[model samples]
Target: MMAGTHGQLWYLGMMEENKLKTSEGTLEKARNSEEWRCQGLSTQRSCHFMAFPSFEHVITMDSLCFDSWFTPSWLDEEPARNGFAQDGNRCNDHALPPDATAFVTILRNCAKNKDLRKGTKVHDDITKMGLLEKCSDALVTMYAKCGALSKAKELLELHISRNLFSWTALISAYAQQGLGKEAVDCFEKMQRAGLSPDAVTFTSILKAYGSIGAADKGERVHDEVVHQGLLENDVMLGTALVDMYAKCGALAKARQVFQNLSSRNVITWSALITGYAQQGEAVQAYACYEQMQSEGLFPDAKTYACILKACGDMGAKDKGECIHNEISRQGLLANDFVLGTALVDMYAKCGVLVKAQQVFENLPHRDVTSWSALIEGYAQHGQGEQALKTFEQMQGGGLAPNEVTFTSILKACGALGAVAKGKQIHDEIARQGLLGSNFLLDTALVDMYAKCGALAQAQKVLDELLLRDISTWSALIMGYAQQGQCEQAVTCLEQMQQEGLFPDAVIFSSLLNACSHSGRVHDGHLYFTLLSKKYGIKPDLEHYACMVDLFGRSGHIDKAVGVIQGMPFSDNLEVWSILLGACRKWGDVNVGRWAFEHAIQFDRENTAAYLLMADLYAAVGMHNDAKSNQALRMDNEGLKMLEVVV
Candidate 1:
């Protein structure tokens, strides 16, 4: 033997010993020898050497040298002989075995390789080799992982030997692509195919149902899992059931399942806590979180997020800060966008806008939600200009505003009556394609216009809306009434009723006020009667005041006085004054004297009422009586009646 470059021993004398001077050539003699039998350059070694040790040391030095002497050019090339092509030299020894697992392994490897071209080639090779019949599981998994679900389904249907694993693969693929309903349909088909799903299959189906909020289907799946006897030892199944029920607002059932869980993990705690948070059961949510920690279970990011949201909903600012402290102590505050956003929202909702702003400023990364929280906080606090400025800053910070941001700022503008800035926001909303949205955003738009006193613009928006809710109708009706457009207001009210929406208190108020402004006594009376009779809407003080004004302006002094007398609460000085002013206007000395005296009794220092009474006395051609009434009015009310403007 001789040493090679790395000091590895190389056999030197074996070639001469194995060679025989036969009738055939030297090559034929070598091929016929025991040393050369079953030996050749392997394809695997040609591409990349396997780490197997020498297995043919008994072979001659020539064969050993042939194995060792590989060319760099042919290192990744096809195997050849004597610089010539050789047959059967590059065949794989570990070619796929003819079974279900082998083909499944091939498909799995193809998916792991992420090379679709190679995957398809391997698939075609399987088809050509007639392995498709035995390879359905592998093929289904292959097509599923490769994102060819339709092809997988076609192949799955072609085979009569479908299993739970095959069904799970297809369902998981659909779930991965967010086609939750399709995943559910595959589960259904699997059940119809008489395949009993395992825990993984059940979890996948439950997750699909939960994703689309299909609570009933999720419950059905839970029952199916129980019926299959699979829930006895499955922690994952229990947790997933909790999550499914929690997401579907079945909090009571979720809690029942949670309590029945033999063992609980962080995910189980998170599921239940988040369920409570979403239901706005902040007390219960915090209690469960405390229980989770008391049992020596550490809270994770999802747990913190749930509790923080509970704080936001319940306005527990102090508790939210405590949670934030824990989060910071645990060193999880930096990357947790969900928890961070929840903190921002909690502070904002609790009316601690300063803390909310501080938290928002400290976020390492802010999304649309972060900006929205601050915008809403300012708008809610009646800081309209500040809200608008913050919105502009968010845009300057390169975060595009979403619908909530726009609605918040528009509300702020509406509060301030910042007509010019409101118009700019409307323009920007239109430019951003948000003007064409449905009810919520449309309602904000109409409100902005109406509050800014641009009734024509508000009505134009109303005209463009494809659908109108009670809010849209209310916006228009209130808009016209605010502008004192009486006929237009009544028309809107009639149209609202025609659309099958009963008028609420706000709508009725607008209609009554319209009658008061335009002096539509009959229509006002009709609406007032219907308010109590049909709609069971009892009249408030504002409604009665408008009715009194309606009759008073039309010179119905006695009727106005009668209406005031019939009011639930004792009539105030304004009601009696309206009656007295009407009496003076119509030269009714008898009723004017009675109304003036009643007004004086209701309020002695009623300057307007005293002035109206004196005028009434003068109008009845009793100069001395008028002067005496004016002198008494001044002496009693502690002022000169001549100085009263009315």
Candidate 2:
């Protein structure tokens, strides 16, 4: 009987073990079924229920037991289709228990769709079910992704158990929206919370550093990345480092990170190339492109655009044309407006207007950028009439001009001296209400009026500006100077200085030119001294040329010669030519001869100097010398015509 009892006890123990195994297997099967149901729900197009048997009794018994749980038919379903319900009132209003998986799936779907309304509704349901803490990270991510950062922050603060994902989502939202400092602060808070940032988090924060030009912050991040051994293991993170440093103008550091990258890709090369291009380092950009090509990495649309921009910056027409042909060969320009615009800009800046216009016409679709590029090209090349015509065409095509377009066309008007068109533009500017706020447009208006010889209008515009920059004052001063109104120019200069605006080189050049034309020798001397001593401005070649003209025009030939001797620039024909013309005016034969020789020595093909010399000899009754110079002038004119015809 004892033996029989021992057997029964052993059998009972075996039976209990088998029952436990069966229960555990059922739970495992239920969890797998729930995962499958969630995946199916995520992919569904519309809300429709399908019974999932494996999820029956999936929850632990400690929670409210259910015979089965209803997986919401589709997480991404439109609320309108389902007759938007509040607080746990989904599809059938069958109150499902607060399941972490269900809440996570719904919140993630809301985040993916960027539907803040649905996300908030789901959050309300989660709160009603008393599972807010359990679903806090998902809710935070949903809010952050939907661009409700304040709500995300409030939710995070409300929860005592903030996870890494919640913090990362908030930081990413701020970084993506260009709130770099806020993102950095979030990062610090995350570290203080004892959560180590992963690679994705690092990328987001590094981008924040790049956006704000915070190279120092990026460097510190680099240290963290190295400490985490992320650099060698992840190319994307390494590329982010290169891009971040490159954008912050730390090319050396960028290059160092780039070289250390174990694997290089097209994106990595493009980042370095774009950095150099943006900094106007054309040679380095081109060299990087070549190296990338040698490595068998094909150039994409972005890479082509960046290199084309570099070509534009350097005026490398030959290189630009070659790249253009390659782009055409690849059929890249058929649909890429950005690449097409870059091409137009390149040709225009290189003085190849014909090619620029050809590219402009060939563009499949032209946006404001294309039109602006073509207009700016004409304006820059002094073809103001062409620029104005293009502007009219752009308007005819139903494209309204933006501020950039207006600025370019205004420059064209100024160049052509079209006062009526300028006035029309002024009216348009007023209609757009741009005159009161856009300082650049206002300055452009002042420049247009000044260059069109409308001094009063220029002054009126200047006076109307609520905030006047140095360029504004300089424009009016230059207009007065060009009109030989020395007193007005001087008064404007004094007013500008009194307004705490320091004069730059261009302003001084205008003042000196005014003095030269109005024969204010003493005033010119005083201003010249003030330029170096008071303003601490070192005179450039143009300033020195203005001085030479000022001295030579007022019968101070010796002083002009002295100015020329003291000039730092070599091989300048303008100063020597000015002296020669002054000698002709003063009838100084010997000095005229000396000036002519020196001018020709510096610029052998200067026909103006030859003509001046012939006139000088004719004024002094030297017939043979005059006839010889006149012959040389005629010969030079013939050569010019032949070259033009060729």
Candidate 3:
């Protein structure tokens, strides 16, 4: 009995030892399998169940267990009969795979399709299988692609062993969402983790830098690309490099990379063209477009849009019309609202309001941009009533006017001196909260008030602005000048200079006009001298004309003649007319006759010269010469009327 009891104890002890060894072996196998899975996941391709050799037997067993769960017949069954239904509970009795590779595949598909609902369901399955920690990177990628950035960030933070794939996923998510600075921060953290970024990673970060105009960061990344030799044989990276540099306003570098590229596509060409267009290098943009066509690369909708913008910038109406015809041929305008808007803007900027309206009316859908473009064209062309009508129509169509729209319409009101309309627009602008944030809008408001002869209102708007640019100061100064408030205009000029805002040609023109209207000859000469000497602004024809009017208005005929003679260009009949008008004003017949003869000699059809000469002759009692001048003016007027009639 004792020997039998001892044998039983030994047997029990041996059985316990074998059980312990078996448990240790299973735990070791699981750890090894996890490490293997991670190594495969770290590769470029998606992680597949077959990639994990250690888990193959387990996956095969799970596949058998869940064979009925994924069958074609099951997929076609009703929601209550299928185990894979989004809300069904038929699969609750069966256990899913430990690694959840099948669900991961489904999540990847959901991400590709951008289906958040299915992705969420797959994530729930992953969580229930207790595979969330292992499959965190896949979840991040899915959430990122689905635009669920918040959920992606949560998963990224929860994952402890955040590898290159994990970091790249988050960085890409930030970039796609236009969170450039956040993407850069993630890139820095990734580098600190001692993992080198691949070409795709570099491209994503470059896009981020481009979107935010972070040229400094983009340059650093370019250096990295050079060091890694990643630009060779990588067309996508090369295109991204070109796009980044172009968008960052480094056109020279962009061109260098583009020329050296082994391959060039429409995307790179369009990027370069867009850069030139945005920089106002319209000639270069057109040249690039022609060159692209010569190289047999057709323009896409974006490329066409960019070139149309270039045409508008340069006022190349013929080029714009040609592009319009091409776009119509391609049927691009039928469905592409952006392209249609570009067409409208191009026509409006080129001073072809009729064409702009035709295109606008033909558009299947018109956004605020289309309406704003037409309104701006009318305003710019001094068609105030038409602009207001268009604004009302836009409002009637239930489209809210944006800042550009309001600015255009306000300008129309100012041009027509419609004070009531201007006030109503002002209320709307204030209600939109656009006044405080945008200096341009505020300047527009001041200009509107000033143009309407409401100097006090203009001054109030100027004073309330938190920040003021040269345009803001110039607008108020011009307002005072137009209202003959010469003292206030000069004071504003002094204040603007004291505040370190250097006056440009526009401000100088306004100042000279103020002096001319107020008969401040000395101040006009002083400002004219300061314009050239202090500010280095060469006087254009407008400035010279203002000076002639200033001298002529102040009873300085010889000084006015001196200005006309001193002008660099001699064919300016406007200046001569100013002198002639000044002679008539002060009754200097000899100088007036000389000015009239010279004006007619320069431009034989100058009606102002003829009219001024007739008035001067009549003022001095030269009735015969006055009749001759009047007859000549009548003949000119008859010819003009005939031309119009024809």
Query: Using lDDT as the measure, which candidate wins?
Result: 2
lDDT, candidate 1, 1-646, per-residue tens: 2222332122233224433221111211223334332222221122222112232222222222221212111221212322323323322222423354565665665554332444565577678878778777777777777678898888888884467777798898897778899998888888888888789988888778777889998888888888887777888899989988887888999999899888889999998998888877889999999999999999887888888888888888888888889888887867667677888888888889888899898988788888998899899889888898899999998888888998899889889998788888888889988766767888888888888888988888887877788888787788788777888888877776787877888888888887877778898888899999999998988788778878887887767777888999877766767777778888878877777778888777777776776777667776666667445557645345543522
lDDT of each: 0.74, 0.79, 0.77
Counted clashes in each candidate structure:
0, 0, 0
Tens-digit per-residue lDDT, 1-646, candidate 2: 1222111111111122112121112111222222323222222222222123222212221111111122222322322232332222222223334487887887886676565766787788788888887889999998998788889888876773348888889999999888888889888878887788899899889988998999998999999999989887788898889999999999989999999899989999999999999988889999999999999999898999999999999999999999998999999998688899999999999999999999999998788988999999999999999999999999999999989899999999999999899999999988988886877788889999999999999999998888888988888889999999999999999888888889898999999999989999999988998999999999888888888888888888889888888987783888888889998888777878888889888767777777777777778887676766344444757445433322
What TM-score, computed on C-alpha atoms, does each candidate reach?
A: 0.61, 0.74, 0.76
How far out, in Å, is residue 92 in model 1?
14
* Every candidate's CA RMSD: 15.7, 13.1, 14.3
Model 1 residue 203 distance off true place after TM-score fit, in angstroms: 4.0
RMSD over all Cα atoms, model 2: 13.1
lDDT per residue as tens, model 3, 599-638: 8877777766777777777788776767663444447574
Against the true structure, candidate 2 reaches a TM-score of: 0.74
By TM-score, highest first, what's the ranking? 3, 2, 1
